[model samples]
Target chain A: MSIAFFAAFFLAWQYSIVWFDIPRYILTPPSVIVTKGWADIDRLLYYTWITGVEVVLGYAVAVILALPLGLAIAFSSILRRTIYPFVVCVEMVPKIAFAPLFISWLGFGLLPKVIIVFLVCFFPIVLNAILAFSSLSEELSRFSVSTGASVWRTFVKVRLPAALPQCFVGFKYAAINATVGAAIAEFIGSDQGLGFYIQIVTGNMRPDLAFAGIFFLTILGLALFGLVTLAERLLIPWHISVRHQSR
Target chain B: MNPLIELTGVQKVFGAGPGALHAFGPVDMKIEKGEFVSLLGPSGCGKSTLMLMIAGLLDATGGRIAIDGRTVVGPQTDIGIMFQDNTLVPWRTVRGNIELQLELRGLSTAAHRASVDELLASVHLEDFQRRYPHELSGGMQQRAAFCQALVHQPATMLLDEPLGKLDAMTREAIRTDLQALWIQRHPTVVFVTHSIEEAIQLSTHVAIITPRPGRVERIISVDLPYPRDFEVKSSPQFIGYVRQAQEIFRGYGVL
Candidate 1:
């Protein structure tokens, strides 16, 4: 069904410019975009690689940092009271505003883009993880205690696995945000990456090239999102959402 | 011998200051070792409150509760408990959930593999051992939960309406399974329920509680014989205990 939808949508996109007598420069056909992308495969590959790095690294750093922080905040009143407010305060500020500051401070390199991506991905991961960690069934809590489970044991054996399904909510959000974040960072200031390539192509009035950059960016975004979903399926196949997916 | 569980004027208040809510109260009871005691009352009459206090999961606002002559200072680790909701971890299969108890207690789940499978078999959940909790029927889930509670063989079992969520047929089936498990190994049980028949069918003694700001109105012994399954539930003696409970509940303005 998804394939059919894509095929129909792309077919319309491939022919609509000709049907409407639209100029080639204004709106490129899907075929033109694909042809141009394939002709400039090396350049597209290079820029896509750059963007992919920022997407993966930035998101990875956020996951590594935010997940533990979230779980910590949930587990400790001290962290919840002290750290969580600061997190909320940070979240309140528009994440895009950080792109300029990051680029200026860190310079126009991969570091700035990565930081922006990390910042974009951080809040949801942390907040959702906190919710996931804390949202336990009273029954499971009682059962864990009844088994004489220590705090650490309970967290590892009971709390962690139970929290994964919900934790994936944050992870998925972070994954989608990662691509946009990298794009924003690159947009604000960068000489390389697909985001920068699109800027260059659009400036040159080569909409086909710009469209190809977007196509690659979309693939990158979907791939990262799919990675998270795949992990969710693997880690928590018992979750109702995942269970329902198979059926 | 002293009772396995003792409550001396135990009461629970939810909060303090002007907002203090008297949940349940100043009721005392003693439960001997291996005795199946049910704290039976109408809904919202603090039946589960009593169970939590005994489990040491919830603190009493006043007085004291002790088990084996020691005051319950914190959540007791040496017991099994079941709630109305089947507490099976969604990520685990039936077998894994049962093994979780031993795993949490720093025991080897692999060593107890046979026992875990045996627990599944006892509940007739062996066929679905590999299935997740969400995949099972409500009765099957509760049965698995019952095994999860019983796996470690705790000396005292605090079961708060384990069969409450199931339909009548499923409840009856699991009730018998519970009896069979208990009969196999007579752990001291403190069951909380609103069902008088459920109380009488399983309990050796029933402690009737009055409505809100609940206190134990009286404690009556149900002298029915072993394996109080469906047949015993309909037995004249079982009906007699039911009437006795109803008689006490009647005085408290309950049907």
Candidate 2:
């Protein structure tokens, strides 16, 4: 960690004028993203927390709602016929175009931002879940049901495990979607968050702080992705990817 | 004792249109308790379809399938089935696969621990109990499948070409193991296979069916006694039976 920090420090110190030509505006240089990242640390921490909460809550809501809905669309021919087309229609609708209307109805509150994030992140989970469920090999399904498994049991025991790999694909996509959704929500409304900070600072032409805000959002997205990857590993250790990694 | 299973006028038809296909026909069959019967037919001859109907995985368009005089409307816990593919869930270990029936019955894990171990030992898979299906060879996977079918101690077992995936040597070895396991469990068994020699080696009765829109062409009883050996394959008795079954197939224009 120290070596990486010094290397970055050494390179930035050697070439600060080349990277950020605005002398007065450059502030403390690459070191400042960390130092001011600490000085405005409270604001940094606050917005980070808000955006983190929004991303997590929005992603959680998407998963909770997506799972059963996805399972239904994947497993039941009737439900798939009834609801899948409508889901696709809603998913294709431009979520960003509704930002002004969301602010108007939801009153520039956290609720609007969360709703936007949910809208953006929900589709992948549902679509991937459906795909995963559909992809289960027929023989496995037959085996479970023939062994006296009820429909629900067959789904839980056989279908769910079979779908986990695809579900992870959905989760990975949702994590990125959550961050972008949170940023867009903060762009339109909200008093605080990395997205809010980015919008406010960028309007006043504080590109350095804007870049910092962008940096934190990237970190948050990466962290969420890392958590999901950890979960995937735990849930399916026998999976080829996990098995190969272990070896 | 009365026969363990009866299939009367069983028929299966697919789709409804001018181009609709008929894969099987109305047929009558019976298997005594503890007997191994083979429904021998080529692919699409409705052998697997017949097995599915008897397993209660599919409904018959015409006729009844009964287990010990009880009509089968849907799958019953007393009947276990295995398909041609090794259907072990890739996520489950060998022991977990075998314990699936017990899990369905909501049998306490503690209650079945010893039995699960016994089945693993019987399939000669005790050492690989913790290994996943993908970790096992094709033969091991099929053995795990067989163990899973018999785990709940079903009164009858339906095997749809269970050893079809293995190589010739593994196929022979598994066939031997399957026969031994069948005797040990003593479940009335119906196995579907295209191999004439397999039918001769494994079955008390071999029922040959004609091609698509299949019907029973002949039912050849192998009066030769049980615990059949490899030598039985080269015997005059076996040769005679094979020739007769072949003639029946020839009559149906299947050979």
Which numbered prediction scores highest in lDDT against the true structure? 1
Worst 10 residues of 1 chain A by lDDT: A139-148
Model 1, span A201-224: residue lDDT tens? 899999999999998999999999
On residues B1-255, what C-alpha lDDT tens digit does candidate 2 reach at each position?
656788899999888788777879888888888888899988889999988888787899999888888898986667788888767777888888777667766667688788888888887999999998998899989999998888887778889999887898988988988888777777789999998989989998999888888888788889886677778777899889999988888877778
Q: State the lDDT of candidate 2 residue by residue for A114-207, as single tens digits.
A: 8888888899899999999899776776666676767777767777788999998998899878999988888887888999998887787666
Question: Which DockQ value does candidate 1 get?
Answer: 0.81
iRMS, all models: 1.1, 1.8
B98: Cα error in model 2, Å: 0.8
Question: Poorest 10 consecutive residues of model 1 chain B by lDDT?
Answer: B224-233
How far residue B121's Cα lies from its native spot in candidate 2, in Å, is: 1.8
User: Could you estimate the TM-score for every candidate?
Assistant: 0.96, 0.89
TM-score of chain A of each: 0.97, 0.87
| Candidate 2 clash pair list | none
